[model samples]
Target: MLKIVKTEILKLKRYHILWAGIALMLLSVMLTLFTSMANDGSVWDFTYMIEQVIKNNMSTIFPMCITLITGYIITREQKDNTLKNILTIPISFKQLLVGKLLVCGILSLFLGMICTIFTIMGSFLAGFPGFSVGLALQAFIQITFVNLFLYIAVMPIVILTSRFSSGFLIGVIVAFVYGYCGMFAAGDMKLANLVSVKK
Candidate 1:
């Protein structure tokens, strides 16, 4: 398992997927800081500010990052025509898929936790005036749980896409559309409302 994880990490070195998470974390922190500063220190209008921060960051960032990473993980081997070689190795298909999913899920969850921690720390540093360590920890736990659930929910789709998709681009498009678009379409009737409004 350690070897599999290490190999996966090495594979990520050539990809922008890992960096996307870091960039998003930095961007979220900057946004939070700017928002607080721009408000002239009067943005304390909620009891769960840290929780709000986590939600805002995750909702805005996680979908795209997770999709890109997961999509690439599913498609990279196909793009390089290495899946055949990988399959011939002494590993079960289930193990390969599960190992990849576990590694990617851990990476995503770790990034999410780091972002949440930074947000809370940034809030405190910006003198937001209501920084509770307990609240911050709670927010972290909640965001981590959400991240894990999202990862598990999407893992099967990724594996299925990998098994059947003919090309990298097709796989990526399918994964992104299904993972992100389907999510919005299922939850937000606003898209339908907007279409009807336009009509």
Candidate 2:
């Protein structure tokens, strides 16, 4: 399983879809910056900017981005006609899927870190105040953990969709709408509390 996971990671080294995920992470931060330009009378600071970016990521970017990337990676073996070779190594399809899922969990954390970096860079570009080491640390933890958990939430979708040919693309669309629905969900106090930790 470890070897399989390692091989899966290696397969992503020169993958173009990986870059698209990174770009989407950056786009989340950029969207936050654009919102900062609005005269909504809300003061933007490093912490607030981070919150906004996190919101954007959860509702708009990370779900679809991670889904698209993970789906492609998982299905690529079959698409490239390499699944048979993998199966010849005494591994069942279920074991191969578990390995891929584990790798995607790691990928989620990696993309989270990438999003955090882009968040900080976006903060610098926007010149938001109240920056501190503590805030940066908090942002990193929040963003990374949120992304990992988010991936877990979307795992069933990936698993179900990967069974069909070109189903990941459908999964991508479903994930986008599924994620975007969170914004509406947050509007109701009961639903919001159910979905978020109460401070």
Q: Against the true structure, what is every candidate's RMSD?
A: 5.9, 2.2
TM-score of each: 0.68, 0.94
Off by over 4 Å in 2: 189-199
Q: Write down the lDDT of every candidate, Cα atoms only.
A: 0.63, 0.87
Query: Model 2 has how many clashing residue pairs?
Result: 0
Best candidate (score: TM-score): 2
| Residue range 1-199, candidate 1, lDDT tens digits | 7777788777877877677677877676777566655645555632345655554454455544565577677667777888889889888767776677778888778877877777777776766666566767776886676666655655555666666545434544544444434335534577534322111
**What TM-score does candidate 2 get on C-alpha atoms?**
0.94
- Compute the lDDT of residue 172 as modeled in candidate 2: 94
